[model samples]
Target: MAVYRIGEILRMKREALGISREKLCEMSGEICSPQTLYRIECGKVKVKRETYQQLMSCMGQLPERSYASIIVPKNQYLSIKSDIYDHLVFGEFEKAEEKLLLLEQMMDRSYPRNRQYLMKYKATLAYKLNKIDAEEYQRILVEALRCTIPQWDEIDMAEWPYNEQEMEIIFDILHTYHALNLDEKYLDACLKLKMNIERHYMDDDYYVTWKNTVHAIISWIISNRHQYEQSIEYCENGIEQLKKYRIVGNVNRLVYDIFWCTRQKYIESNLPEKEQAPCNRQLAQAYYLSVAQNLQSQSEFIRKKVKQFDIKELFFL
Candidate 1:
């Protein structure tokens, strides 16, 4: 079966050399059609050794002296890595991590700095594990960032292929750092990267998604510092942008976070009844599970002190 597949690779190589199926049939004096060529390429049909040689001769190109010249019976190293990456994108973090560990063992450490794809994968795995020993994770991030920047710069912006999957992996790292709240510099770097992505890849959907994410993170940071007005401004700008671009997936999450922040602001300001009520209702509904778990504490402390509003009436409204 494997030998048959090897013959198929040879057929594809011939076709790629610009040798038409009809031309190959004429040169080799063998009956062949485009459908026959496809079947061979797909490994559903086998060819005799002499037929394979004749086919190669017709194309005036032959496999060279390289590992890829001879097809391996089993999957190649990169193929397995590709499969693992697919699993990672689909949220199979555990299975992806297991395969990544195996891949690390097989890696040639002498070429440690080579293979940008592998480095990116390692960075992504570290992010998934939430391995937050800063020095370690940042080391991986730095390498991945270095690789990504150069690639991003060289491509023609007009025709560049946006790797959404890779972008998502990097976003995971950024979101992780945001969660830890320990690496402001790294987070800033992430925001700069997000801006670069938006500037150059506006046509790509990821641009909007990442932009909203960064906006949401920035709003959170500002809100934590008690910069309520600035926080609301950032969140409102982000929400407006998301709406403008019709990016709905993360908009709701951002809205929920923004509402919570707004509620906090109202409580801090001791805002008037009419103004605080809406924000309170929004926070309560968005964070119902948290509020439920701490209902007594919330009523005694948060609800009581946030005296401008009535939770019961707000919920009814």
Candidate 2:
């Protein structure tokens, strides 16, 4: 069993309600000492079956097994999340929508941590599908932010895999706010993203994936603003990071972003009309050729993404 997950679920639920450890013990009729409760919540000691039942019953939950047993297996949860992201990357919106529904159906609301992840993913998927308007997107994000337990210890977050998903959410917010021309909110999101990156203090040195993901988010966020030079730099940096810890899907995404940024920069350039037109055409042609070459060596799933782009109309310039 994932002791950390079990403890995090318990702690997040209790903290979300502003219930103190002493109050939790009192509510459970002091069935376990406060020190013991602390140990369980810290994942230093596993709660006994009876103790688990007693504590949960006090919290108004009645499960057939221990809280840990009711969780979706970590591997299965990760697989579902990864599959949804892959579908999105490949422009398989229909498949992404289907998998997201399966994920929602599989989610356990009793676990607030899972709910946090679900809300973020659902909001992103909804935006991608055009199922939510800008107002609805902001509303959903506000609600999602309000529910995250503020007191969660850094230790727990560092232990969790895919920590960069938080940065991705900020990127989504930055993009949305930019579209709405909400400069204040966009700047706030950018600052939050910076803080998030700086505060990540993992015990282990093997965090290449986290670093790559952060760079990718930075690249994508700036790309939305047509800040091509900075965006391209971040994209190149991210590509190098991915090279160090190569994942085909991630590499494909960074390259795609880089291509789009390059095309955007070309279109937005202030060169002489003659130079601008030729430059834009050259960039678009190169982008198409690069994508075609990359997809040609991949599976049909990836090749299908090529159909989504039309180089001729991609840059109005």
Candidate 3:
């Protein structure tokens, strides 16, 4: 059903412009009928992609663009794009490719932005298939990044066409960069990912998970660079945030990350080898705690071991 608010907005805009129904139809090149416009204004029928495009143009709302031929209808495009996204995420390359071909056919080749998004998906597929070398993949990423989210500060993802799906895809590319150990790219990607997550905070499970994942990745990167203290801090903050949000996803991994960072710093501390055993014991206890919390059957036994070894005191220490 047509939303009444949309009808009201259309009526108000049309009246404010002092454009009669006949003049509006004339202005719209008569692509939509006057009766259809009346139905839209009365909320009798739902507004369609073409009708909305034309009506908005008549009201000087939609800017003129050369991508006019790329009309696959909004709903169909969204459905197909969603299917493609699902297939790509789940490693269903052949299915994703099939749908991608249809999506590409629906796009305007004249539009550079269209090709940039396609290149991102293509680069992602190529990377997954091991067809492109890491350098080539990174180059493709650089190229795609040029066009995606240009002027990130000036633009709002929510206001973008397609609800910023392209921007989300760019985040996937950043994740791949992190996975590849492309340290040079981490600073930019992490900063942007942080900003993106902050701006689009949905207060939902997925957002929480992704935010924690990014923090964990950043922690891992920082630790590899021998910044153990910062790594521990990031891990601690992430674990606490997850707990505060009541997110039960395996936070043990992050706690173990802290343990690993602590172990690294201990190795660098130059303490007597005998004295290091206490720290090693604490590290082992941390690992055991992670395993116990992760597995129900092991939790009871690990709890007993923790008490036997006085590991609970290690927590306070």
For residues 173-282, write the lDDT of model 1, one tens digit per residue: 56656556665754475556555555433344556666777777777776777887787877788778777877655554565666768877877889876886666555
Clash counts per candidate, in order, are: 0, 0, 0
Clashing residue pairs in candidate 2 are none
What lDDT score goes with residue 55 in model 3? 81
For residues 136-182, write the lDDT of model 2, one tens digit per residue. Answer: 78667655643442333322322222233343554565678867977
Clash pairs detected, candidate 1 = none
* TM-score, model 3 to reference: 0.48
Residue 67 C-alpha lDDT in model 1: 23
In TM-score terms, candidate 2 sits at: 0.49
> Which 10 residues in a row give candidate 1 its minimum summed lDDT?
63-72
